[model samples]
Target: MDDRIDVASLGWPAGLVGELDHRRLKAPSVKLRSARAGEHGDVTYCVDLRIRHPNADEYLTSTELHSVEHFLLEGFQRLLPEHFVSVGLMGCQTGFYLGFVNEGRSEVLCACLVRILEEMQAATVVPYANIEQCGNWRNHSLDDAQRVAREILARREHWLDAA
Candidate 1:
């Protein structure tokens, strides 16, 4: 029985395909999850955004994660209005699952993520971090979000390396 998963057939971007191939030949590591093509010809991707540093915090704090989620939702929509679908936080709090309508280019998505992080770093307040817009509005932290965004941006080269 072959346990290997054929990622190429799933319409993943080249980088993710190569990463999966490498993982198959070696030990398992973080990498993009999957991409599914909708009946309407749209592609939705489940991409991972894990932090791999050994000494650093393994997962984002709740406040940081929430703030980052808000920032990403706003940024992705503003930057990729036509393609952006939604951003959902991972249960483990290490990263997020970013959904897109038709966009499949990993590089473009990575670039957009970088831009979003940059915006987060410079943001003075968290959008929708209010009682009217958020259920736990008072639980957000812009400072922690900015710090985590800065850390992630500093390791931008490895953004594609998923878990």
Candidate 2:
């Protein structure tokens, strides 16, 4: 049998906390895993949050991705119109990429993400999980996403700048 990991069973994208400074928790020669922070002259500071589901077999379904995309993109744009640029799932169904446009913006973005996760955990009905409003409405899983979010929150301190 092939011994290579399925990539999802690694149960990672968490536990990156470093003495409360939130350093990049790497898997040691497996992959490049870390949140990126940088800025341009005028554009907003880009804060990227990378994650993967604890369960590799439990990759995000289309509806799940769509629902999350809708929730984050709309919510952030509405809440942080000046900072929020874009929010979407990675093609690999591992995590999300969030963009912002201001100095010292990662804190706000990270805070918002935590808030969203908290809300997502308590939320039973996804905001746009409907056939009329969603393309793959039937394939979403609020439970799974919330589970991942909760795990992320528990280890939320891992999201910080090391460089």
Task: Pull out the clashing pairs in model 2.
Answer: 8-56, 44-101, 44-102, 45-102
Candidate 1 lDDT over residue span 89-128, tens digit each: 7776666767776675666777888888888877899999
Clashing pairs in 1: 30-162, 30-163, 31-162, 31-163
Give the per-residue lDDT of model 2 (tens digit) for 1-163.
1123121232322332112222332211112132223433444333345454333453556655666776676667777887677775768664566665542234455667777778887887777778898777776677766766665676566544222
TM-score of each: 0.77, 0.62
What TM-score does structure 1 among the candidates reach?
Answer: 0.77
Off-target runs (Cα >4 Å) in candidate 2 are 1-41, 53-64, 161-163
For model 2, give the 10-residue run with minimal summed lDDT: 25-34
Candidate 2 TM-score, true structure as reference: 0.62
The candidate that achieves the highest TM-score relative to the unseen native structure = 1
